[model samples]
Target: MELSVTAVILTLTAILCLYYWNNRGRRSRLPPGPPALPLIGNSLHIDKRAPDRSLIQLGRKYGPVFTIWLGPRPAVVLCGYKAVKEALVDQADDFGARGTIPSISKVTNGYGIASSNGPRSRQLRSFAITALGHRGNGTSTLEGFVQQEAETLVEAFTKTQELPFDPTFRLTCATANIMCAVVFGCRFDHTDPKLLALLHMMDENMKVISSPWGQLYDLLPNLLDCLPGPHNRLFENANKIKSFLREMIQLHKDTHREGTPRDFIESFLAKMDEEKGNPRSEFNDENLLLSTFNIFLAGTDTTGSTMRWGLLIFLKYPEVQEKIQSEIDREIGMDRTPCMGDREKMPYTNAAIHEIQRYANIIPLNLPHTVTRDTEFRGFLIPKGMLVIPLLSSVLYDPSCWETPKSFNINHFLDERGQLKHKDAFLPFSIGNRMCIGEKVAEMQLFIFLTTLLQKFTFRSPVEPSAIDISPLSSGFSTLHHPYQLYCIPRRPARRPASE
Candidate 1:
């Protein structure tokens, strides 16, 4: 009976694929791509683990702007700096819509800024940016919170005391605390059970999302939904986070004071109450919960991973670390903590941080975008609802754009005079309307946390710097550096100590 059921299911799947295959040619003037097979489409041809690499190779053959069918659905990929810029930046409106990614949709339930489109997405995104900015004003309060966390982080590293140790949890905790302060209006104790669980869930979700299994779940969610796999755990983890958020929302509602918004949640709750009667209002408990989830999750992973990568890179390149430390010593000195304002005077340190982001290329295949309407783009006719990916890896590593795209050279962001220079192609947070909502917060975190560490310690790895592998261990939604232990040796102070 089981065999018969399996056979029937396969037959139905084959028929559906045939139907999609037959209708595929009906769409006219679609971007060019490699020929795809029935049911699987280009799944066989592409590398699930490193889809960006596969897509980059495909871009070379099919030109910068081309199509590749994920399953039955065809996605138009804008590759290289020029192509991605044209679509995401120059032609922003046409490609502003968010694609219905099954994996994210399942978790987000078609709500929140990451998955929502049209008015809802716009409303939430705008409100989120405003709320996040208000919370993370980058001046007094936010900087204080970050600097405090950096001190805690330095303390944690000092505990290691020249012993090689993994800095993942310490880094993640520091980063997550910043998010907690911004979103939840508080910070989590390093030993808090709930906070630890939350961080674990966030880390697991990130790993799963960036895993090949995660891509498979996204590609064939329905089938994978039925089968037993890690995807199920992914959904379960999302529910746990959502449940936590829901509980927090209720607590906020119970304690919320009108006209006195504490943080992102209070501000959103206020909006939800204001728009309570409007039928078209996107502000609600569901959105508030999911939007909070989106911010917390996004805020934690990207910044945490980047900082971890920065430390690893520092261990890999001690000379670069020394350069940044010297700049910090000369400009700010050890008595005072590094702040965003100091980023202006420290060109080499600024360039190194930018280089870390560019080299990290964390989110290589940025959040998938879609066509707002049936639009004509770059001599090709892209229909509405088509999945559009502005390959950020292509842009960040485009040979024509950077002096040395492949290498981790800070000179890419430095002029001949060794002053900081801006490169238009640095889109690690992506570009235009749907770019990362937490870009500013992430930037602040990276600059402050990294500079703080550099000021406090000189990092060295167990193995020789040249032996360290800078290439990511995994690459799907994001590129994660291979886990490695490093020694954090505290630097002697050059200035008088300030009062704690």
Candidate 2:
């Protein structure tokens, strides 16, 4: 019995020594960070609900570049303007690869533009950017599509009859319709059941992705997969979106002709046919469906959420809204719709839009990036597969970068003459090779949609503007503004006839 006890003690000692040696080696190689416990790592230090905020706090303690052990895997977080810019922009190629988030990868099956890496990522992303850039025909530019959707949105708001309503649903539909037109070569009515269902799924997925539970899933996917929770529902919703896109693909296939591609879907189909015989080609129905899913998911939520936040911010600061309206009225007038060209001339309006994006700070902790090869960054060795988070919030809210980092200051984007001045650190769409694909489309949507709304209406909340909580409702991977109602009072046009 004593011999057996001695043997057990020896084995336990050996395991402990191995564990310590492993952790010690990792610690020496990685950048400085807070101490992490075994198994859970630094999970306890992170506020699951607001990982971005937690990370910012960590940045304060550990400097710009530091490693945070996310469940035994060290993630080297690049914080503030300088570190992020250096890593993402200066060393772009080294930090260009997309890191796998188990949660996102499972849903995407490592196939889509958002989650892909190396050759596949390059091929799909290049094609996607080109497809997104082209005017559908000679006449149907993306700007035109956005303007048309802005009209539909105006009609929907008009039906609200100046009453207070949660504009989230309407705004989501308007944004999703624009994406639908781009992807499927069609638009859905605001009341379309299928569109509403699709939006519901997308919104739910966003909520899950931006919730504390979602972060937990990303950190502990295998463990959480075994447990019953909302994470399971995220997969269900992903499948639903895929199934819906597949149906749309089938419809496109049936109606497809040889000569002209109507939208992104048809364009992809033509590419697929061209590459049908190429064994290494990434063009396939699976990619088409997943890429379409990426476009639809990204195109809808981001712009919609930003616009929603823009309205909320307007309610929060009426003066800013009025200033933008004045600028729009002066530059574009009310009779005609605002175009992308008007943005250059309307400085304050442009400034306010930039301020909105900066203040909102959506996607605070950017999608994770990975090193393509073993890299020495800032005196620390980050292995090839090590996850790197470019803390976008740090840059947007960096004191060194912005004069008033914490406040809603439109002056951040304005020059002494009140002209819109570009700030290098205003990285709402992030930077480098993996910058947002839908940047142009999003810009157009925000400008045209917000300008259209402001041209016809003065937005106000029933309560005092100062009382409105502009802080995000819940933050995880993304920041979501708290749901609020607003009154849209129609404004009389200054230059044109009322009927016109």
Candidate 3:
């Protein structure tokens, strides 16, 4: 009995020593951070509800660049404008690779750009950017489609008659319809049941994926795989979106002719046929489904969420909205639809939109980046395959970068002459080669959609402007604005005054 007890004690001591040395070696190789426990690592330390905020706070204590263990995985987080710019901008090639989030990877099966790495990602992303840039022979320009959707949105808002209504559905359909036209060569009616359900799934999936549950699934995927929770719903939603896209693909397969590609999907299908005999060809049905999924999901949610946040900000600061409206009316006139050309001329409206994006800080914790090689950055060496997070919230809200980092001030993007001032840190689409590919497209949609809305309606908050809570419900991978209703009073070209 005495010998057995001594052996057990010796074994425990050995295990502890091994764990200590292992962690010590890791810390020596990575940037220093808060002490993390074995297995769970820093999970307990992070505010699950707002991991990005927690990471930002740690950035305060640990300097601009620091390391944290997510489960057993160590991630190097680049905070503020300088650190993020250094790694993602100065050392772009080193930090350009995409990192795996288990939650997203499982759904994507490591297939698309969102989760793909190396050659596959390069091939797919190149095709995607080119495809997005192309115009279908018989279709209207993307701008024309957006303008038409803006008119449809106008019709939808006018139906509310200055009463309280949630803009989520209409905004979603409008923004998503652009991508729908690009990918599927068609648009869904505002009342389409399938579109509505797909949007509902996407919205919830984003919520759950940004939630603590989603973080855990990313951190400890294998352990959580057998467990039951809302995190599992993401996979279910993925499958549903898969079925939806698969059906769309099948329809395209039947209708799409060889050589002459009509839509994004057909373009991809054409590529797939070209690469049929090549063993390394990444063009296949799986890639097609996932690439489309990534395009559609991303194309829909980020812009949709940004627009919602934009409207929410408008409700909070009526002056900002009025000023933008005044600028729109002055530049574009209440008669003509707002155009991209008008953007260069409308300084205040341009500043307001830029400020809105900065204030909104969508994708606060940018999709994680990876170092494919051992990289030395800012006096610290990041190991190859280590996950890196370019904390965009830090950059957008960095005091050193923005004059009024904490406030929703248009002056952040404005000069004394009231001209739009471009800040190097205004990167809601993030920076580097891996940045959001839809930047220009999103910019046009935002300018047209917003200017069109303000041209037609003066939006009013349901609550007192003082009571309007523009703070997001949760902040992580995405900042989800709290659901709120607002009233829309028509302007000149839309309709006569409600009272008149």
lDDT by residue (tens digit), candidate 3, 1-500: 99999998899778867877876654586788998886788888788877888998999999889989899778999899999988888999999999888888888888976788888989998988777766422133877888889999999999998899999989999988988987897899988999889989998998898888888899999999999999999999899999999999999988878776767899999998889999998998888999999989998888888899999999988888888887886788887878787888999988888988898888989999999898988778887888999999999999999988878888888888888887999999999889887777788888899999999999998689999888878896788888899989998654557794
Cα-based RMSD of the predictions, in order? 3.2, 3.2, 3.6
Residue 337 displacement in candidate 2 (angstroms): 1.6
Tens digits of per-residue lDDT for model 2 on 40-138?
789999988788889999999999999897885678999999999999989999999998888889988989789899889999999988888774222
Give the top-scoring candidate (TM-score). 1
| Backbone clashes in model 1 | 0
TM-score of 3: 0.93
Give Cα-based local distance difference scores for all models. 0.88, 0.88, 0.87
Give lDDT for model 2: 0.88
Per-residue lDDT tens digits of candidate 1, residues 1-500? 99999999999988987876786664668989999875577998788788998999999999999999887678999999888878877889999889888988888888888889889988999999888776565774878899899999999999997999999999999999999888888898999999999999888888888887898888888889899987787889999999988888888889999876878899988898898899999998788888888898888998999998898999899999999999999998988989899988999999999999999999999889998888888888898888998899999999999988888999999998999998998888888899888888888899889999989999999999989999978779889889899988899976668889
What is the Cα-based TM-score of model 2?
Answer: 0.94
Model 3 error, position 489 (Å): 0.7
User: TM per model?
Assistant: 0.95, 0.94, 0.93
Weakest lDDT window of 10 consecutive positions for candidate 2:
133-142
Query: Which segments of model 1 are wrong by more than 4 Å?
Result: 1-26, 494-500
- State the TM-score for model 1: 0.95
